[model samples]
Target: MSFYHTPKALSAFDAKFEAQKIAFGPISFQVAHCLLKFEVLATIDQAGEQGLSIAQLAQTNVLNEYALGVLLDMGLSMGLVWLNGDAYVLDKTGYFLLHDDMAAINLNFVQDVCYQGLFQLDKALVAGKPSGLAVFGDWQTIYPALKDLPAEAKASWFAFDHYYSDHAFPQILPLVFAHSPKHLVDIGGNTGKWALSCCEFNPEVEVTLMDFPGQLAVAKDNATKHGFAERIHTFATDLLDESRPFVEGADTYWMSQFLDCFSQEQILSILQRTAQAMTPNSQLFIVETFWDRQPSAASAYCVNATSLYFTAMANGNSRMYHSKDLIKLLHQAGLYVDEDTDNLGLGHTLLRCKRKP
Candidate 1:
């Protein structure tokens, strides 16, 4: 069953409450973030089941009593904390915010990279341009500007981007290496993480990274640092520039969490160019978190919400794709899905495509 189907899980009152939550989401999010940032949640969590009163929590040197009280009051309404008599305790959701790696990474990414820019989302939608990205500078997309982003934003952006793809690497390494590819091309090779992974996976495999010069520079640094300098090569070019064709020698081509950085039309153009450069024996692997294929509603929700980040901050037209839509694009590009594997490391679906016969 599709995970996107509507459900009658909430009552009329519950639905209204949910709507109110959405209405107050921005402020509530800021309040909850402040609670975590000031270590208010940590104090309550450290207090164990005993919890802590506003006065006691303030004594921990985290925040003043007034600040603690106001944030806690909002936190209580937001369900991040609970009131047991006069004491405040962290809720399960709060626990995740404090401890879950994914949650923490996502939180940082949202706050550092997306928060301010997203204020211009309405403008972006109307103009079909990243109006929110004006907070950063005059970049057409976030990718090229990645290197120059403010320190916190750069860190959070990489953490968020790498977390999703890095988790799936170990599982996919065997599958991709099984083909015994002599040369592999890593498209949209951000920071050379996947290229490094391939180098480590196969001692003899030589990998080429295709991306903008700035990104390639970072990737090259990472490659040298990891001692894979000789094996991991760089090809600097703009994929959106249709005049530049794909570098044509690799037996294996890989794009992990990459294609979704483009609109359907752009994706088609990219796939077509790649297809044109491929030999009959070439194999291309596409890894993406297709929202419809998520393992749970929560995962699906996160993926869907991330689509807006693309619209408002990253690029103005791209989004997380449905597997069917991507597959149709692949077919239109003269490629056929030879293997469709899902549920690989954090809901990524790996589509192994080959040139149509």
Candidate 2:
């Protein structure tokens, strides 16, 4: 009973734990890398119960069997595989990695983008900007390079970006549509992913997506795929510029996974313009990750890394503003915070505001 009160011992334990984590960091990185590379789990899924040998796996995926063996051995150490007499089989944890089940969320996106992006962490820290942008110069400028990426890689990026709303939106829909907005505008709505989700959930709602010309095409394709082409409209515009065309008579203006890609001045300006375009009864909803007054280690890492990534790649950053700071920003634009819902998923929060109604 008294051992718990030993502060010195506890501090020593924490130090040791941190040291261990630092030492084992590369293990974590490699395990994830190997998993994605081998498509071990995915391969198993495709091949069914028939396990593949290292040679078979290598030939099938066009990989070097010797190099893959090293990685697979590492994975076995991490308990992700079972080495059963020369044949490799997916263990319980490894099985999930292959299938697009619950754990699909983890393997698909974060591992592909965030993991790879971390290589430039030092550069991001030094430059005070996202490593992607720092390395690539601009977000739009990098797409041309990615055009030749394999389909799996592209799908991984899409999965990661869509992780914000994939399955978490339904839980927050009640809180989101409590005010029952009719006409909705999604600014910087990439591919209309969120807009489609909102429209699907709220059948009576009409959504207009405003984004760049390149992205509008993707959004249009998404709308068509969702059979909401008639209900969803697309407009191309630069949201940062003063000459941007605005959405009018909208009961709700939604920015999902948006708004973090700017300076405070830019955010205020955008909000002010949005306020001007809204009716007195209109509402604005911003869904984003929030940093607590004293953020946890995981939250801090995610927010800081994401901020750097966006800044470097897209000229954007993630701001984990507190509730009061959010209110202040809204008020600066003549809008007021009406309500907020926390813990949407991970460290995310939703701030629902209106035109000082």
Candidate 1 — which residues are off by over 4 angstroms? none
- lDDT of model 2 at residue 266? 80
Candidate 2 stretches with Cα past 4 Å from truth are 1-14, 35-111, 114-117, 126-150, 293-305, 311-316, 319-324, 345-347
lDDT of all predictions: 0.89, 0.69
- Candidate 1 has an lDDT of 0.89
Alpha-carbon deviation at 240 in model 1, angstroms: 1.2
Q: Any residue pairs clashing in model 1, and if so which?
A: none
Best by lDDT: 1
Shift of residue 127 alpha carbon in model 1, Å: 0.9
Per-residue lDDT for 104-148 in model 2, tens only? 654554454455656676766576555653332344433443444
